[model samples]
Target chain A: MNFNSAAFLVFLPLVVCLYWLLPFRARKYALLMASWFFYMYWNPLLILLLLASTGIDYLCGLGMDRFDGNPGKRKLLLCVSVCMNLGILFFFKYWDFFGECVSGLMAFCGIPYRVPSLNLILPVGISFYTFQTMSYSIDVYRRKCTPEKDFVYFALFVSYFPQLVAGPIERPGDLLPQLKKEHRWRSEDLKAGVRLLLCGFFRKCVVADTCGIYVNRVFDRLLQANALAVAGAGALFCIQMYCDFAGYSEIAAGSARLMGVRLTRNFDRPYLSQSYGEFFRRWHISLNRWFTQYLYIPLGGSRRGLLIRLRNTVIVFALCGLWHGARWTYVLWGLYAAFFVCLESVLEKPAGKITERLNIPLNNPLVIFTRRLYMFLIFIPAALLFRAGSVQEVGQIIQSLLAADFSLTNALGSLGMTSFSIVSLTLTLCAMARIYDFGLYDLPDNGNRTEEAGRQVSGVLMVLVIALCWLALLATEDAAGFAYFQF
Target chain B: MQEWVVLRHPELVLLYGLALLLCLMEKKWKASRGWLFYASCACAAAASAMLILQGADLREAAAYLTVFLLLMPGVRA
Candidate 1:
């Protein structure tokens, strides 16, 4: 269910209470049941997919463990597990795209064959949970982690409701042990978790949702809009996305923490990154780490020459983009990032030397100011492809950006904002800037002094933000589904 | 036309100027970073309120500001 919805508002607290009240051994079972119910809330059919995946991986992990000294048998079991997981993912996610391509080719060749569409529903969180399950089997095969003997705990690790839907993508090693241990609710962890949840609600409902209204308006009519409107849409799109995804992560991490589980953090102040490499390291950290360990390193990583490394980087990102969706635009988005990373790597040495020679203070306010402006300019256009519905739409928006109608008056006039809308927008922007500047991600480790102060401040602020957000949401007409729900 | 320009963009400039001023004051004040954050949040809320009331075309501007907020000094790792 959407976090913004009234149903989830009721569902979250009920599940949390049950989780804490259950005996340690029963807690895993409770979670497993809750997670199944949660997935079924979207579609009852999806529960079958989740169960099938879980059962396959569970048996695979045991099979791999049982065949432990024999390399050939183990490899075969691993292959089976990989095929099953990937097969499900491929059929559900990519079958239509492949079908369309084949159909188009047949039509061109004057063949009367038409590929029939199954109209299959893409299961929500399939990509995330599939990857999570795969990691469990792979880790078992590699002997990095033993097979989880307790079926219930292993199932809960795979399906933990908070991070299950949109994940921080927990590793078997990181998450499994916690499930095996007895969980007693810590007052501190509970307070901290609740605070983070409140912060997340504020970011999502107050900031992200508010910005989304304007972004949708501008993007929906990009062709008719002036350059200013186009630019405004592009810029707002970035913010809307960040708040939407990051807000979800915060809620997930916070909720999990209340249950005494520490999920991986998903974002760092990614935008503040001075370089593309730094940005990737900080942004969607779990996914980047996943690609690095499972994909990049396995593909020879940086052990080869620089050129090979660059090629590998591009390949990884291209897959990363494709992993987000079946669309060509996502593929282009992946290539776009690959281009930046390649360019940054090539220029790293020369750029460093240039900066050093110029003797500009690397962290000087002026240098920081200019670098931020340059990065903002670079980020928006690149991000446009990801937000656009199609390649053509993206092109139209870019073309509008370069057009000659650059009047400030016409731009503001077209937005058709009420006075209240204008005030609300300004307040939202300022609030976002402040949160970003304070390094919201750094709150967990804000030095000793800040930490001590943070306990009291964050507690009070957290309560206030949550109450305010809940109230705002209640007053609003409806909660918008998360922007990333489609993926 | 000129009045609108003066009213809208100038308010934005002033808001930014205030942000910079707050940053400068933060350096001198030695307050906890959390308080600074809270203050900045207050300023942002105020600015957002103004934008909402004024009916400014904020989606794009807010988007740019969000990116700036993200990649800029405060958010820098």
Candidate 2:
């Protein structure tokens, strides 16, 4: 269910209230039931897939424990678990994508072969839950974590409502232990949860949704768009995407926090990064952590050699791109990132020398600022590729952007914010967001006790103001569905 | 406040400016209950400013105060 929807608005509070009121032993049961109810709210039958995944991993974990002394049996069990999770993911999520690719290939080869496409519905959260469960099985096989013996806890861990759909992709080591712990009411946790929820709503409703309006308007008319429209849409899209995904992450983390569970930090103000390598480290941190632990490191991480590392990077990113969707654009976006990462590595020394030759201080503010600007400008094309419907759309966007008119009026008018005041407000809001990220107005946290208490009060006030703004905007605007929900 | 009135009056600028100032001051000085006092004042000032911006009709001011006060408990948390 959409987080901003009325159903979820009702569901979250009722669940949380009941959860805190329940006795400790029954709390998990209440949460598990609530989680299932939450997931089933979207589609009743899809709960079967969630349960199927949960059952497979639970048995796999137990089987790994059963065969702990036998390497062969453990490996076999791990394989079965991985294959089953991936198999379900493939059937539900990627089958149509695969079919279309094959059919296209056959057409290109002048062969009249065609694969029949199934009319299957892609289950929500299937991709996220599968990876979560698969990671559990792998962790168990590797002896990184003990297999969870209790079925209910295991199931709850797999279908935890907060991060169940769009995830911070919690690892067994982190999330499983929290599930086992007995939690009581903490005012501090509740305070933080409320703040995060407010911040999340403001970002989603005010920033992302507002940007989405302009982005959709321009992107939907790509064929008729001017250069300014394409560029504006591309830039706005980058904002929309980050706010949408990161907003969901914050809300997820906040909800989990309210339950006394700490989910991993998923975003770290990625747009503030000066480099693509740093961006990946900051953005969707949990996913990168997963791929690094499970895939990249296994493929001989940076330990082997530079070439191998590059190869691994490319493979991981390409797979990462494919993981986002069945679209070629996502694959290209991933490859685009991999290419930049490789380029950054190769140019690191040369660029440093050039800066030194230019008498630029290594820590010069100008140098850092320019690097941030350069990264953002360079990111525009990649963002365009991501927003495009096809490779040809990407080309058209680029061409239009290149052919953009130099007139200010055309540029400002293209995004439908023809009025100066609206544009100014939007820009001011964007600037405020940047300043907030940079901690320019950040209150000191670890200080005198009085100071800390005062800061807490101010923080709450900030939350209220944000929530007020969100409500004001939300009353006039429709909330946009999160961009990452498709994955 | 009505959209045209808000556009015409500079009261929003004053309220937003006061909010921004309080925010910055709170960030700068952590301790003092003085900051809390100012925050409350800022909220009241914003409401007053909204009323003035809307031409000081009690009904409009009441609406502004109602919305502002409604947000108070959440911030109190």
Candidate 3:
């Protein structure tokens, strides 16, 4: 069930209440059952996959621990677990995409063979849980986290409903230990939890979904749109995506916080980063760290020669893009990001030399702001690449952008928001979102008592305004599912 | 839509006025911002009742206001 839905609104509180009311030993069992119910609420059959992955990893961890002296056997067990998890993911998520690719290759090669697609429905959150479980087995094999001995606790860690579906993909070391502890109800956690939930819902429904109304319209009739419309919609798509995925992450973390379990932070004001390299460090931090630790470090990372580091960066980004979906567009999107990031890294020395020669002050606020804007604008084409249906569609958008019909009225008119009321509503909502994301009106603190109070009060006012706008938005626009749910 | 008309109706004006007053009081009496939370809730609940009496849909401004208050900052703490 979606976190924004009324059903989950009821379910979360009821589950949390029952969890806290139970004793410590029964609490874990209760939480496990609740998590199973939450997962099964989406699809009853997929719960089996969850159980299978959890069981395999749990057993693998135990086996690795038992054969700790035999490095060969430990390595074999880790590989077994990794292969099993990936095998399930491939069957459920990637089988049809693979078949389609092979079929295309066959047709191009003048072969008379056509590969048939099984067209199996992919289980929701397969990629997320698969990566999470693989991390557990790998960590156990590497002697990082002690193997979880308790079956129920381990199961709870794997199926923790909050971050189970779309995650700030938790590591075993971070989350498993918390599963074993007794949590006491705290008012502070509840307050912070509710704050996060409100912020997430406001962003998802009011900002992202409202923007989706226009973005979907423009993309639906790409041929009818001018350059300005496509580019405007491309920028909105970036905002929509960040809000949608980060919205989900915030809600997940907040829900877990209500149960006194703190998940890792996923986003950190990525839009404010002054460079593409800095953007990666802030955006989807958990996944980036995962790639850095498991993939990049294993491939020698930046510690190696420049050629190896560049190769590793490109390979990791390609895999990262492919991890998002089973489409070539996603791969292209990954390559697009890698290109800019690599360019920035390779040109760092020369760019510094040019700035030195020009006598540009690197720490100037205006310069910093300009750099941030440049970094943000760099993502527009990448966003187009990520969201386009096919390579041809991507070409169409780029061609339209190059044609340069940059009229604002023509763009809004094409999206069916030509009327003053609708246009005002869209712009106002977008402004609120920008302010909310960037904190444009933060109360300045001079360390006085009244100023501190004013700061707190201003924050309270911001949430109130966002909440009011969100409610109004719900009355007008239909809330959309998060964009990341597809992956 | 008629929802916008209902939002601007005379009956809802008092609710907004009350919210404004509570907000000002929150600023004046810095030690007692709790009243703003109550005032926000009471205004929403009363507005919802009025809308119900006027034969309007419950999903109008009242419902929105109620949710806004429930999740409004500084309420739980």
Per-model TM-score on C-alpha atoms: 0.82, 0.86, 0.86
Number of the predicted model whose DockQ against the real structure is largest: 2
For every candidate in turn, the CA RMSD to the true structure comes to 6.7, 5.0, 4.6
Q: Count the backbone clashes (under 3 Å) in each candidate.
A: 30, 0, 0
Which residue runs does candidate 1 get wrong by more than 4 Å?
A109-112, A413-419, A436-478, B1-77
TM-score of chain B of 3: 0.58
Ordered from best to worst lDDT, the candidate numbers read 3, 2, 1
Worst 10 residues of 3 chain B by lDDT: B68-77
Candidate 3 lDDT tens digits, A1-487:
8777778889999998898888888998998998899889888998999999999999999999999899999999999999999999988888888888898899899997777788877788888889999999988887899999999999999899999888888999999888787888898777667757766765676567766777888999998899999988888888888888888888898898888888898988898899998999989998898889889999999877778878888999998998998888999999989988889879998999999999999899999999999998999888888889888998889888888999988898766664543644455454444335322122333454533443344344445445544555566665677777678
Every candidate's DockQ is 0.10, 0.13, 0.13
Measured against the true chain A, the candidates' chain A TM-scores are 0.92, 0.92, 0.92
Flag the better candidate by lDDT, 2 or 3: 3
Q: How accurate is candidate 2 locally (lDDT)?
A: 0.75
Candidate number that wins on TM-score, 2 or 3: 3
Q: Give me the overall lDDT of model 1.
A: 0.74
- C-alpha lDDT values of all predictions: 0.74, 0.75, 0.77
**Ten-residue segment with the worst summed lDDT in candidate 3 chain A?**
A437-446
Query: How good is the docking of model 3, by CAPRI class?
Result: incorrect
lDDT of 1 at A290: 86
